[model samples]
Target: MNTHNLIVGISGASGALYGIRLLEACRDLGVQTHLVISKAGEMTLHHETGLAVSDVRALATKSYKIADIGAAIASGSFRNAGMVIAPCSIRSMSEIATGVTSNLMTRAADVALKERRRLVLMVRESPLHSGHLATMKTLSDLGAIIAPPVPAFYTHPTSLDDMVNHTVGRTLDLLAIENNLAERWDGLKNARTRSQENDGGRD
Candidate 1:
């Protein structure tokens, strides 16, 4: 496989763990990640996830200042396979929707959209207002995938890590990276077969 490149951005949202999990998954897959974190993201990471900025930085292959608009990833010709904005905040969503490339995160997203590469925004807010919905629509119309990080209970997640892995795994799927972070429905076939055999014997 060619070296799949991903641009990951973390914004001020409640779920910093999602981003961290995503980074870990990408690293394990040997995908080169260009990471950017907003100022509020740093604050949220500390307050909610109990992760220091240094620790978060350690997860990524490379880290860029959000204000570093001149970064290679900020350009359309950067040749990245895709971009993902994990735990995307409403503010960041609106900026990308309106084509405001103020920072490296938004700029890289804009580049992804323009380049027609996969751009998955894991919007984390809930109880959306008209403005937020409208922004999502706008980005969607521009070929961006607005993936809200809604939990999947059907997976029978046992802990917080399971939930985080499921969402991050789906995000990786969107980026076309193969990962086994979450259990797939097809894997249950063997269990179903065993259950049927036991029921037959009992009958």
Candidate 2:
């Protein structure tokens, strides 16, 4: 498959692992990633994931300083398949919602929205307040997808990796990237049918 250019942003969320997983997945798929990490994200990367900034940067094909507004991805002319803000923080979401391109992360997202490209925000906050909801609504109206890193229990996940993979898989699905990170409901249809058959036979 031809490599597609993807813009990935890491914000100051508790789950930095999602961004790391996304980077690894993109690298494995031969996708070129333009990565940016917010200042808060840099601290969180070390605090939460215990990964050095340089180590994290090594995962992506290209890295850019978040404050660098002159980055290629900050312009609409630079073509990209899409942009994803994995573990997107509420602060970052507000920035994107308000068109504040102070950093490359938000600037890339702004370019994606203006260029009519897929802009997926994997917001990672729990028990959100009204302000957060309002920001999400604003972004939704601006054609940005506000997806949270909610886990899917229907897959009967047995490990932390399973949960993370499921969420990341759904994010990729939204971006139209085909991947089998977790089993779908279709795979359980036959098992459900067989269980029903056994119950009926016992009755």
Candidate 3:
């Protein structure tokens, strides 16, 4: 396995920034990222961030086309640390869950599952119905981590970037990558103490 390599998938989802932030974080940490973006992903990336497809592709160590099922990351033998589908769309998640992948992104995810590698799907949907929940359950049963990008209030995010960084940092933690992009929770006692200290100074 390539200990320094990580497979990244970006699908058509509302939170395209999550995928971009993940790639930037990995790049900062010196991790080699193998990226694959779906057609809808490209559209969303542009619509949401106004970033060109080539610009996003330049962020990764390597990039693959969605139709390239023969790509190295599509094979279990490719040997990477694991795979992460940031801003994973419901359709993409369903494809992975059912093993009915239509593109290299989902194909790579399926390969990750078959290889017993950590597959983190940052599902980006809200007000999920029973069918969506069932699909998530199925993916979980098959060894995929259904980690929705739920914000952490404890992080006390003052801006959108903070929230994105926190979520991406937590996801990287799941991938076993060390990153200081987000503030770490020390303890409740420490938090209270800090709060009290600030209050004392305020008065």
Candidate 4:
């Protein structure tokens, strides 16, 4: 109900954990989340995370059926912060790119774009063709952010959870969602300079 509301869309991408962790982070911040998972997203959740549909639903402040295109998030008048499609599939990306709102997931993304709100797409695909690159460009031109869950190793992540957390945390940063989920790189370059001075420019 507050302006801090975030609409989350989980598509059929492989990294279902990203979406799950994003919801957990939102709960940690006490930000209300509206979750909508595609049918394939449900299958991926069960396959990869072993989370039942209800389990995923329980992570959010509210859940919506994928086909519920008339949901509040589908309208620009919903007055929310923004939307993020974690583990967004190429199929769903195309739908949002073309303004084809076949379901609530893409419909909400459409609303985010039309209202000039932040729409972060955590696209989860690899070996992309030129078409994929071009669609992402089109979305960027339309003010949608193509934020794939790429891991940052400068923080020296120890595990998969660290990677996911850092990626999710960065995506939240794009929306100005306050969090300390990942270790920030603070003055590392300056520290390296001091270390070089101590070492006399030698190994």
User: Each model's number of backbone clashes?
Assistant: 0, 0, 0, 0
> What's the distance in Å from true for residue 5, model 3?
0.8
Please give, for residues 125-193, the per-residue lDDT of candidate 4 as tens digits. Answer: 999999999999999999999998889977667799899999988988989988888667779887677
lDDT of 1 by residue, 1-203 (tens): 22778899999988888898999888899998889999999999899878799898888889999889898898887888899998899988888888866788988998899999999999988799888898888999999999999888766677988898998988888878888986676667775665578679453
Estimated TM-score for each candidate: 0.91, 0.91, 0.95, 0.92
Clashing pairs in 1: none
- Give the per-residue lDDT digits (tens) of candidate 2, residues 13-78: 888999999998888878889999999999999998788999999999999998899989999999
Best by TM-score: 3
Q: What C-alpha lDDT, on a 0 to 100 scale, does residue 203 get in candidate 1?
A: 31
lDDT of 2 at 122: 93
lDDT of candidates 1 onward, in order:
0.87, 0.88, 0.91, 0.91
Question: What is the descending TM-score order?
Answer: 3, 4, 2, 1
Which of the predicted structures, 1 or 2, would earn the higher TM-score when compared with the native? 2
Relative to the true structure, candidate 2 reaches a TM of 0.91
